[model samples]
Target: MSKRLRSILTPIIAVLLGIIVGTIIMLVSGYNPVDAYTALWNGAFGDVYYTGEVIRQVTPYILAGLAVAFAFRVGLFNIGVEGQFIVGWLAAVWVGVAFDLPKVIHLPLAIIAAMVAGGLWAFIPGLLKARFRVHEVIVTIMMNYTALHTVNYIIRTKLNQGSAKTGMIHESASLRSPWLQELTTHSTMHWGIMIAIACCFIMWFLLEKTTRGFELRAVGFNQDAAHYAGMSVNKNIILSMVISGAFAGIAGAMEGLGTFGYMAVQGGFTGVGFNGIAVALLGGNTALGVFFSALLFGSLKIGALSMPLEAGVPKELVDIIIALIVFFVASSYIIRVVLDRFSKKGVK
Candidate 1:
């Protein structure tokens, strides 16, 4: 099988296997798999409201997935996306609440603040990795804790008067659209989806049609070779993390300005950044692939809520299915070997 065929088939087969395993688990747990799946389907796309919610969920997933995939392309493991996302959300909310400018200026300024915060948050680990050969994964993981506590402290001491969250952002700084809400029957959808889609195209163009992208890819493929070719490996590494963090920042902006319109103190990780790793993996780490994979993940997340409400199935079952899918995708070498054997036999 060709590489392209293998790439396409692997995720499809993984998804099928996940569904099969989920069915068996549901049966063992005394639930009707058919009813459960039907409910899941309905919750995702049965009405305009649900569809809009799915799209809204997908918007952040797409940006977060791109963040991870971009780092992967540069051979960097950016475990700090969660931290970056939180800081970005906080920064955007700060700007949104503090400014009283016109809609165009306020909105763009808030969004830029988000991107800058996220980028700067990631830059610390990137700088360490590039300048001191520090392990980025460890640093980023630690940074996640720092970001969590720091944001909580800021919220308690600075932003919130008595509540656990800052005030709602100004209307001019918000991403919500009244027309879009009416069109989607009041789903929490926003213009962030358009930004996500535009980022997808930008990612594709940058990675596939630019000299800088070639350098980044080259550095990722072989640092020694890239150095020999006069490419600045350190620069690319820093640039990659910065760009990846920017994507993740926009994801946070979607949650802050578009979905929630406020920044809240969190007791734990939001899981969106972590889920982006699975999205990137399932997408084969490509821009277009990330877009579609995010949709699938988003659908599962939104639909999971209906499983229990409609079919008496546990919502956690959906988590199991998602875990299985990721497992199968990660273990795709086994599938590839099996396909190769079949191809060899057919050739004979």
Candidate 2:
């Protein structure tokens, strides 16, 4: 097989192996695997409404995945995407609710605030790592908690304590498209999917076509070497983190402005940021890969929510399936061995 073909086939084979294993787990657990799968399919694609919701759910995942994938590409592990996502969501919501600008100005401005907030959140850790030699993983993890609590506090102390949600956003700031609802039957899916796709293209362009992306990758691969080659490692490191966070922020904004439309004091963290890790891995941390992986994740999530109602199965089983899939995907040696065995057996 060609190297390119192998690259593609490896992941597909791994995914199939994961599903087979998951079926065994279900059978052992005394659950009907076929029924569970049927429920999952119905939940995800049974009707237009469900399919739209699946797309909507994955929209944020795509953005978050892009954020993590971008950082990984540049040799940075930005665990802080969670915090950046929260800050971005809060910031975007704040802009949407607090401002009175025309839609032309208001919508873009609110989204931009999220990008800035998320970018700045990442900038701190990036700068610290570049200048003071701090471990970015630790700093980013801490920041994630900080962002969660900070947003919670703001929601209660400043944004609103009594109300679970902030004031409704201005019409101009809303991303809802009324016309599409007629087709989807008033589903939650909005324009965010389009934005996520756009980001994928943008990510590809920036990384493959831009000089700045080259510098960032260089710093990521070898900071000392990049420095010796006249690239400012500090600048690239900071830039990479900032851009990663910015993408995460836009993701948050998409969820907030495009879907939720207001900030509610979240009782706890939303799962988007953390899920980005899996998304990054499943996507292979590439722009196009992230896009397709996001769709898979989104569908799984949407389908999971319906299992309890449709098939008397625990919703959490989805997590088990996801874990298995990720494990198989990340462990290439295991999959390669399996593939070799299959090939020898002529299992085609």
Candidate 3:
């Protein structure tokens, strides 16, 4: 089979297998999978409000997915995206609360602050990786804890004046849209969806149509060969991490500026950055693929909220399904082999 076809089929088959496994689990637990899925589907799409909520959920997932996918393309495992995301959220909310400029300036400034903060946060790990041969994963993991505690400290001692959350941001920095709210029955949907879609195109164009992208991909494919070709492998590696972290920062901005008007202290991680890994994997690490995979994940997440109410099923079941889907996606080689054997049998 062609690589393109295989790429397309692999995710589709993985999703099916995941659903099948979920069905078995539901049956064993004495719940009807059909009812559970129906509730899930209805919750995600039954009302215009629900649809809007899905879009709101998808916006950040797309950017987060791009963050991971971009690093993957450059052969970097940037586990620091979670840290970058938190710093970005802090930076964006800080700017939003501190400034009172016009919407044109304030909104852009807040977003830029988020990107810069996230980029700088990731740069630490990238610089260490390139200059000191430190593993990015280890450095990034440490950075995540650092970012969490540091941001929480800043929020309580500085930004919030001992409060657990910051005050509401200025209207100028908000991404909320009255028209969109009216259209979606007052859902939390905002203009961030436009920004997310625009970023998708940006990622695609940068990765697929630019010279710098070629160098990054070359470095990813083979660092020694890229160095032999006189490419600045170290520079590309650092650049890729910065760009990837920038995407993650924008995702945090969506939450700060769009979903919530204020920032709150977190008891735990939001899981968005980690979910981005699954999204990137399911998307085959492509821009279009990430877009669709984010939508799927968003639907499942939003829809799962209704399972308990409508189907008497626990919401955690959705997590299991998602985990299975990721497992199947990660094991694509096995699926490919099975497909090859099945095709051979058909040809015979």
Task: Give each model a TM-score.
Answer: 0.98, 0.95, 0.98
Clash pairs, model 3 backbone: none
Predicted candidate 3, C-alpha RMSD: 0.9
After TM-score superposition, the amount by which residue 61's alpha carbon in candidate 3 deviates from its true location, in angstroms, is 0.6
Q: Write the per-residue lDDT of candidate 3 for residues 51-72, one digit (tens) a residue.
A: 9999999999999999999999
- What is candidate 1's lDDT per residue for 170-241, written digit by digit as tens? 999999999999999999999999999999999999988999999999988999999999999999999999
Task: Show pairs that collide, candidate 1.
Answer: none
- Please list the residue runs of candidate 1 whose C-alpha ends up more than 4 Å from where it truly belongs after superposition: none
Predict model 3's lDDT versus the native.
0.94
**Model 3 residue 155 lDDT score:** 87
True-vs-predicted CA distance for residue 221, candidate 2, Å? 2.5
The C-alpha stretches of model 2 lying farther than 4 A from their native spots are 336-348
Instruction: Find the 10 residues in a row with the least total lDDT in model 3.
Output: 154-163
118-226, model 2: which lDDT tens digit per residue?
9999999999988998999999999998999989888888878367667777778888889866688999888888888999999999988999888878877888899
Q: State the RMSD for candidate 2.
A: 2.3
Q: Is candidate 2 or candidate 3 better by lDDT?
A: 3
Which candidate do you rate higher for TM-score, 2 or 3? 3
